[model samples]
Each structure stands twice: as C-alpha cells, then as structure tokens.
Target: MFLFKKNKDLLEQYTKYLELCAETLDIFRKAIAYSFENGLNEHFEVLAGKVHAMESDADDIRRQIERTMYEQSLLPESREDLLDIIERIDMVPNCADHLATLMTLQRTPINPALKSEIMELLDLAIESFKYTKEAAVDCFLKMEKVKGLKILIDNNESLGDKLEHKMIRTVFAENTGTGEKIIQKDMINQVGEICNLCEHVMDRIVICSIKRQL
Candidate 1:
C-alpha cells in the first residue's frame, strides 16, 4: 500500500513536469511571434527575458522529474521514454533563446524578397509547436488522442518544411551582397529549425505513448 501511494505521488509529479514542458513551449511560440510581430526592439528583449526565465524553471522541473524517477524506481521503459520526451521538448526553448540572441546581436532588416515567405514559415512553425503541446497533453490526459494529434503535427511540419525551402530559395535569389545572403540564410535556418524541433519532440511523444500502452 505504501509503495502504491508513493508511486501515485510520483505520477502526480510527472504530470506537473509535463505542464512545465507545455508552458515552456508556449512561451517559446509567443517569443518567436513577438520577435517577428513587433521587431527586435527594447520590448522584444523583455519578452525574451521572460522566455529565458521560464525555460530555466522548466529545466529545474525536468531535473526534479529525473530525480523522482530514480528515487521511486519507475519502470525503466516509461522512465526512459519520458526522459527522451523532456529532452526533445527542451529543444523548443533552446531554439527560441538562440534565435532571440541572434536577432539581438544582428539588426538585419527583414529581406523584402522573403518577408511574406518568412512570416508564413513562422505561422506554420508556431502552429506545429501549438499542436505539439496538445499532443503531449493528450498523451497524459487522453492517450487515445495521441495518434490523431501526431497526424496533425506531421502535417503542420510538412507544410513548414515546404515554406522553409521556399524562403531559402527566395533568400539566395535576392541578388544581394554575399555577406547579406549568408546572414539571411542563417536566420531562415533558425526559424525553420524550431518547426523541425517540434516534430522531433513529437516523435518522442509518440514513442512515449507506445510505451505507455506496453
């Protein structure tokens, strides 16, 4: 009875860990939008700071989850799966921080040739993470919903990839200075990578779901 109750408490902690992961992803999504929507001015720095803090807090929770799993002797399969999911989810915030830092250091105006294409990629990338959060929540709250959310995440990711390629081709075609072309390509790659990270995490979430069933 004591072991069962202890396991229950650990499970509750697991749920909280997932909540932090979701919150971090949402903050990352907003940070990306704010960077693009308002431009990287003073206000952007404030939003980025918030994201940084949240990511830090999420990291703490992730460590706590790890410790709890070990202390309580969680099943190895579920433990490993959950750890993988958390690690992948961490990439979302890491990407946001990297992108924010890059923009702060470089004040390159959005390229006219790829502005619309870039914004389209941002929307698709944000949606991908948005659905990623849902799929993660579904894994915890409604395991059966995981498969459907997985499909939507994949679709969003596919469209994001196409837009990324389109934006890149547009960037190279701009007939700009070589230095300028390189900077713009780097920016586009970072943005596209956020979407890619979402799909990567979703892959882990799907695996976790399968482990849950087994």
Candidate 2:
C-alpha cells in the first residue's frame, strides 16, 4: 500500500512536471513572437527568463520523482522506463530554453520578409509539443488515448520539415549577404529542431504505451 501511494505521488509529480513544460513552451512562443514583432527588447528578456526558471523548476520535480521511485523500490525495468519518459519530456523545456538563449544572447536578426513563414513554423512546433504532451499524459494516467497520436505528431513534423526546407530555400534565394543568410538559416533550423524534438519524444511515448499494453 505504501508503494502504491508512492507511485500515485510520483504520477502527480509527473503531471506537475508536464504542466511546467507546457508553461515554458507558452512563454517561449510569446518571447519569440515579441522578438519577431518588436525585435529583442526588455520584455523579451523577461519572458526568456521565465522560460529558464520554469525549466529549472521542472528539473527539480524530475529529481524528486526519481528519488521517490528509488525509495519505493520499483522494479528496475519499470524505473528505467519511467526515467526515460520523464527525461525525454524534460527536453521539450530544455529545447525551449536553449532556443530562447540562442535568440537572446545572439540577438539573431530575423528578416522581415520571412516573418510569416517563421511564425507558421513556430505555431507548428508548439502544436506538435501539445500533442506530445497529451500523449504523454495519456500514457501516465492510462487514459487510453495514445492510439493515433503518433500519426498526428508525425504528420505535423512532416509538414514542419517541408516548411523548414521552403524557408531555407527562400533564405538562400534572397539577395541578402551570405552571413545574414546563414544566420537566418540557423534560426530556422533551431525552431524546426523544436518540432523534430517533439516527434522524437513522441516516439518514446508511443513505445512506452506499447510496453504498458503488454
């Protein structure tokens, strides 16, 4: 019974961890949008700081969850699977934090012309993370909605890839200087990487779901 209670508590921690990640991503979207519209300004820095703080909070919770699992003496395999899932989920925020840092530190100059496409890609990346979060939540809570989520995530990721390529091609085609073009391309790749990371985490979520069924 104590073990059961510990598992329940751990699951609750996981839920909180997921919530923090979602909040971090939300702040990231706002930060990027503000930067795009207003350029790197004071407000953008505040938002980026919030992203970093929330990511740190999520990491703390993950550590707590790990400690609880060990104390409860969960089977080694079960512990490993749970650890893997949480670690992957944590990366969502880590990626958001890294992207925010890249933009904030470098003050990467985004071409005005590419704003529309770049914002579109950002939307897709956030949406991908949303589905990834839901799928993960479903798995932990045994909500049985994991089915078909992988396909949805994959489809969005596919669209993101196409959009990324289109944007890069557009970047190179521009009459901008080579250095500017390279910076723009790097920015695009970082945003696209968020989408790719979502898909990668979803892959693990799906595998965990399958293992649960077995």
Best by lDDT: 2
Kindly report which residue stretches of model 1 are placed more than 4 angstroms away from their true locations once superposed.
Answer: 1-39, 140-142
Score residue 102 of candidate 1 by CA lDDT: 67
CA lDDT, every prediction? Answer: 0.72, 0.82
Predicted candidate 1 versus true structure: per-residue lDDT over 60-171, tens digit per residue? 8778878887886666765676677778877877776777666666866456567677777877777777777777656654476778877887887788888878877887
State the displacement of the C-alpha of residue 208, model 1, in Å, after optimal TM-score superposition. 3.1
Reference-based TM-score, model 2: 0.91
TM-scores, one per candidate: 0.81, 0.91
| Native-to-model Cα distance after best TM-score fit, residue 207 in candidate 2, in Å | 1.7
**Can you write out model 2's per-residue Cα lDDT over 105-175, one digit (the tens) per residue?**
98875677778887898888888888888887777566467767888888989999999899999999988
For model 2, the superposed segments whose C-alpha errors exceed 4 Å read: 1-6
Q: In model 1, what are the clashing residue pairs, if there are any?
A: none
